[model samples]
Target chain A: MAWVTPVTNRNATARMTYLDMNRISGNISYLYNYAKDHGYDVQGDDVSQTTWTQNDIISYDFWYSMTGVLGEVREAAGLDKSVNYPATNYYSVNSLERYTLYTWMEITEPPEYGLLQNREGIQLQTESGADIEAGIL
Target chain B: MPTISEANKMQIRQPMDIMVTLQVGGDVSLTYSGYSDAKVADGRLDEPNKKMMPLTDLQGDGYPLNGSCKLYRPGYHPTSEEKWGERSNIGEPCSITITASESIGYVSAWVSGCESVTFSGNDYPVVNGTANIYVEDTTATFTFNPLYEDRRIEVSLLASGAYFIFNNDQIISCVVSLRSDLSLINPTLPESEIELQIYQDEDISERLASIPDETLITYSAGYSDEMSPIRNFYLSEKITWADNVMTIHAVDAVHKLDIQLPTASLLTDGSSDTGEATEESLLVFIRACLLYAGISIGIMPDYEDGASNSSLVFNRISLREAIAKATAWGRFGDYPTTWINYVDAGIPKLESDYSSAGWHIYEEDCGDVKRDAARKIKEIRMPVSALSFGDGGNYLTTNVGTGTWIYGSGAFLDFDDDVFAWSVITEQNAGIASVKSDETDYAGACERNALNFLAIKGLMEEGLPMGSMNTFYTQVMPWNSLQLATWNRYIGSSVREDQNLIIIGSKVLKDTHIQSFSTGEDDGEIITLDEAPIEGKLIVQHLNESAQTLYPNIAAQSILNMSNVTGSFKWKGDPRMQPRDSAYLHRVNGVTELITIENITITHEGGGTSAEITYRKGKC
Candidate 1:
């Protein structure tokens, strides 16, 4: 203020706001389309901006994609994709999508259960209903 | 190490080529090449089912039908990358439709349909105003309705295919089952029969493109060596298939005779007297009997000069049994008896020679022939524990023509004793009441019995062991130095080594009654008792006749004592080692002991060959 120069900050601020809004809208549309295609029920009010912030929408998309990618990677590696997710965290994807991705990966490349075995570790269920573990040796 | 040719001689010859032919009926004959395995057994006794040929597939004209309707079950290919995730049920229900053809009978075509089917043919009548259709899962049944009255058609289901019998004799694709309980008593037959098991589609239908039981089966085996030449092993009997297994029953030639001739048919006519016949005459009679029964004669020894006067009356006994009885009589009648049916030669013949002419076993280390390392003998077993004297500690006596013959010192002869002591007595009016008038017959009978008793006693007095030696040799024949060792070790080690060593095949000569004279006056007939009558007195009128009879008895005893070398030598088998053939054995102790091959058994297992030879030490 003491040595103020005539500079227009409003344009920069408007540009940033427009970019933020566009990013939020794009993330919402992507999530909406994904849910509709995959037969998932869409919840919350899409018309109001107060219910979901631009940051919140971006965060949701980030987490959803992270978990979806994790399921796909596990399936491709011939492993079970049904990982224990955090209960408190909110995700945009439904359980059906997660399970479908897991099944697809399982059928594509079956896992070698012997490699994951352990003598004293977490107990896992086998197809024959027997309890087993990884890294046995 | 032996040379290649020497080693080959010692080793068993391999059967290179095998051919199999199957004859279903008279007209429907099917020959198939390549068999899973084949075995032909040639024996010295009667054997049923001689050849076994198992064909993996059935291939012929118009077999397994053309238009198939779910005839085969779906197959899986786990390694196929393209069809990994796909499922296929292509040949399920195992359905096929066969139409009647010139080779294929009408009954066979209808019976081939395992599932429900509709039948429309010239010989069969249609039902329900159209072709007879047997609905799936329905109680409605359509009988095989043939149009012709005289041509009755019969259909039977077999393990791999269907069987049709028409016009009583004509068979269409027929495969019969073998009797489960078959009798095997003939020793000349093969020890085991041929058994073949084939699965439905994997083994039979797919490979040859035919039904399971619709093919004929036959087999032949041959060797390059002249000893065992090419020969066919065939049987005219029907093939047996059960539970997807086809078995061919092949019996020996003797067994074939047993099946063709009934027990009653072997009875002699009893017209010709065996007693009055010369040695040649008796041989002719025996030859005639064998020829009538379709058997061949191989070797026949000369008859005993003394026993030729003894007459034999055959009633209802079999010819084989009669021949056996005739060969055991006379002075030189202790010959070994054998019957050989050469499967390869297709000849069955009798062998009775016990001479040492062509029998000899050379030692491997002697370097006379090639010595094979594989045939290195490891063990030799000579067991003498079973040797025993016949009728020890018993007095033997017989009377003829007013003279009584007695032997024995009223005590058992000690093993160390050299001389046998005996006493003679004269008895009056102790004549054989039944044959009192026939003094020659009475004298002959008494002389024969007395000789048998003395021979047995003299042979057993020294306690010379009667044992068997089972040796292992690399070669098929027993011509080895180890055989010589067996002979010298046993013979030279004993004090009574002067005893003549007699070699007979597996056949052992026992004491036989040539002629019997009855003393009980029972219509002047001969007495047939299991045991000799010991509680009777014999009567005769002249001592000269008695002396003549006793002379023959003494001669006979000497002959029997010379033939006391009994036992068998078992080793690797060779077809050339026939019974009664003589072989020389070079002993380990620098002695060449002549031996005879008594019995031979050749066995082939897992490409390893061996022979078991039963031989007697010494020449006959």
Candidate 2:
């Protein structure tokens, strides 16, 4: 009977999965512990066993250290550089989007971030000491 | 035999192409082209690289699909080669030779391509230049000029396809060489002959097919764009081929008649009587002789009415010789005289007066000298006496003893003053009455001989200019009987002089018309003109008519000769000038006289055209 539905009658629902930060920190600690036990040097500034939270460890120094360890880990896993899915996924989603974000951030807040935030619903936070002791950092 | 219509058709339809086939041992090479293919083709024809394209789908009659066949140059292994585009290494040089065939048509090349040319000794320079060699009767040989070891060059001879196009309309050139012993006086003799040479590759068969047997051929001084002005000849033999050359031998029509027709005695069935002894005109006699030989008369002289008549008795001579004898007697005291001349169609024509056509001769310094200059003058030797009579004691006179009697009449210049007189008396017993009758017949025969001698003497006394006028540069003469006669008499005699030279004056004693003689026989004597009448015959005196007509004619002609400036002059190739045609000479001394061309020789070659004309001074 009506040509178009009224805006008041329209309703929609969306679902999203968030990143498990605790798991991520735990995985990083395990990697660091494995490297120390195997007598591999953690050759990077400010990258040690104490820096387990995502914020402290999300630096160029930590990333450089992780790249060295990741290469060894990849060898231990019998994986080739070209078929390294973790490295490939990290560069594809993070490095490309980071360059884009940096370019727009120099001028103004990127509207593209709104679309990303809405699509992924990701939230970044600093972990408390209690959370770190609970092994959820 | 082909009909005239068929011959005429063939004449118009000339062969368009010439085909040449060469066979060396087992190797066969066939070449064909249009008559003008080599001429119109691009580049030099003598180059080894030039391919003579054979013709295909030829259109014309008498051209075989394979072409008129002829043997290639035989024996001498000449080779040639042909290439299209420039290839870096054209392989070894191949020796190619080109020569002109005696046949008037077609040029041939021996090609041995893609072969190494080997010399006898030294390595010769490779022939690399393209040359447009002109084909003429001149002999030329193109060789490496170096001695070769093998003399045979290995060549890649490119095959010109089987069929080539040829333009048959090219002018047919030929060289006609006459036998060395040919004489104009007795042209019918076997020794007088002609040989024609033409290119063997030419479709001579087609040309010959167009020409029927006994075909008349007219020769000129040079290549004739117009009609020829020369005497005509009849083909008397079949064409012959040898060494890739064709030859044609021809003879005069009169000669052919002499060979074909039987003797005069045979024509008359061995009868002594030629015909009714009624005085017959010369024209009538000539007509009768030609009619007897189944020949029709064409052009003839127009003698004056009531001209001299002759009662000649033809013996065992050929028809032509008999006709000659008759003409000799008939021409006595007749103006211009008559002779049997043949036309281009092989038809015999009797000509009387001079021809109307005349040749124009200019001075040497005239503009376009080649077109007008008379090249040279040939003085034909004139006979000392026109007629001479010798009586060999074959007939006996009743009053005189048997002895040789001599008499002659043609005395014009001082050179002919000696009397050629002789008497031919028959042997008989002394004082025999029957001898008188035979004497009358003998006298009649003598009179006839005298008349013949006088006629021929008169004509020859004028001096016939028999030398050839090389009118090689221009064709200006027409075929006619007019001649040029030059006189070397005194200046005062240059004017017409009427000399009353008696042609014939004789008297014989016989019985008077009113009187009668009795024979001592059983029966009386019969009267007849054949024999001195036994009773009524009278001593008759006869005088020739030269005083009335012949003297004046001779005087007029003599004056004409004196005025004539006859000398041999070369003329530019003019096909129109023919024997007997009139020539008007413009002397440098301002003396102009109308003369006639007696003979002409036309020579046409690549260099130029010229005619050798023998002319005399006379109008008619």
Candidate 3:
């Protein structure tokens, strides 16, 4: 199933089964700390929660976690850390630092079958056609 | 034995401490040790990473976070087991009190900081992680004693007599290993690499962004003046960080080399400077590759034997491949010798008879260091039947050394008089097997040429038949001594073990025309490789001039008694273990046979650091 692009500053759900939400919070806090230490003015919420879950979608702000934080902070601070870093887009887009940090995210539309890995409809059948059952699962 | 302060070399080993440092320059580096303290609170049952200040869980059990060292995977039971996470310093401002309203309403407080509580009127003191108290009066106030101070950042209050645990699990892990190539006889540059895993910290997250390439990393273990050598593993720009973990992978000089040859030649064309114009010496070619890789030569002797001094040709290829081609040929005498190159301890070396294989410790040869149950060695044996001195009788002997040596005039029925070669086959080899001499082109009698050939191919085995080691190659190689020894394990006679000797693969041998003649004087006294030249420009006594050194069994009887090279032994990792080094292993019958290390892998995880050494037996 494809990733769902998180909605901006709104109710957004996440897959927290394998994902450690505290780590995500730590990651966001680290990003904010890194930008601040590198002499950049950035603003963010207190991600000090001990634990988090995908079910807690109320005011979760997944958008602020992904592309909105640094992407917006860099724009406000008049710094383009795109391909150049330390020198405003100095490092290459394919550089090591770009790969280490979560630089970008793309959420494609979910597959027609939805986000369930083991899609229930993988074995196709005509359930709407009530005349006869021809398919063997 | 391991070089330690004798304290660390006890029969039972201690839990070793590890130090992984990335050295960009001299003293400037980054070091990480395992965390020693943790924080415990109330909400950590469902939220493991929940934050709490003054993390002073002095008696909390430490189930060390995963990704810790494999050797230290079990729970962290420090020597002072009960007081595992306590700091040396302890202080509290004053006692605390809690007030309750109802008589049967017992209040349970799940405090993040200290949980030990004591009533003002009660005589006894209490200590623990959680506290619950009961009072019979309608309203009651309880007093708590002083608590020790640790790195208590913050703590939030929750309802219950519950306790949650959280380790300040700062360090994820680090791993280091040396990867080697498994090509025998050929000159291949094997790569050595090391990897480090650093868990992210909220304050110092910026360090991950500035990691540079080509930094040197050294890993050392053991608590003594002496340490194991896990050095020369270089760091590349390949790094990754996700889920608060950062990793860096590095390699040796061999792996990072990307030089293309025909490197700026002296001769130039009008359009461009090309390597096609002039053929350069092999020494020049070797230097170009090693120099470009930022690797110094092993400082060994530069050879000028046979065509080694002769100019050679090569197109645009990797500098490493060119080096292999340059070292395969160069006739020293009757036997053709070969040369090979490899990276040794960060230096590019042209090594063939690795002398360092003598002292490099793959296993505990001295038997001083204690070993664990995980240590084991497997025996590999590939045997042969017999060793025919020159040959048996026929030329079509399908085995490795079965063909008979022939030296009578016109004894060779198929080959031309000019194209002299051993009737050798590709038994256990892949090279074009060659031999060469300037005398092959000397304008003389067919018999005169044959004498020079005998001088080169050496005397045929009749009364005392000794075969000089001929290790020639086309594009590949790998061999052992060409001398015969008295180790008849099977049929009970002296035999020449498998050198897989490729003795006839040179320009003077392989590239010849097959001419034929009848036995009725049709060939006209062509040649004989056994006798000295009777007439043309030759002497009988001159044959033994450079011939004695080839057969080292004369005085000391230093015959390089060879055997099958398939035998290899494995041991656990030790920092001192180095590959390509040779040492003695007690094989049998009190015979401490010299073994050459072909591979070495030292792992610094799980229980303690161990080194696995794979060695080739008795080929020297």
Worst 10 residues of 2 chain B by lDDT: B466-475
Chain A of candidate 2 compared with the true chain A, TM-score: 0.29
Off by over 4 Å in 1: A1-137, B1-251, B256-277, B296-312, B331-346, B350-359, B363-572
Candidate 1 chain B, run of 10 with poorest lDDT: B467-476
**In model 3 chain B, where is the ten-residue run with the lowest total lDDT?**
B532-541
The first chain of model 3 has a TM-score of 0.33
2 versus 3: better lDDT goes to: 3
Chain A alone, TM-score for each of the models? 0.24, 0.29, 0.33
Write model 2 residue lDDT over B274-363, tens digit each, in one string.
Answer: 222212233555566677665666544554343222222222345554444332222222333433232222225565544566555665
lDDT of model 2, residue A66: 43
TM-score of each: 0.29, 0.30, 0.33
How does model 1 score on DockQ? 0.00
lDDT digits (tens) for residues B1-620 of candidate 3: 33443433455555445555443212211111111222221222212123322211212221121221111111333222121121211233123232223342333333333535445466322312334454454443333333444312122321222221111233345445453432222334557666666554433345445546766655655554565554565777655777776676877676545565422221111211111111123445456667776766645543432221111223344655445333322212222232233544433456543444444332343323232221121221111111123332323222222222121111112221222233333234322222323333221112232322443343332121221222111112222111111112221243333323223322121221222211233323332122211110101111222212111111011111222343444433445545555566654345565765556565554445555555556432
Write out fnat for all predictions, comma-separated: 0.00, 0.00, 0.00
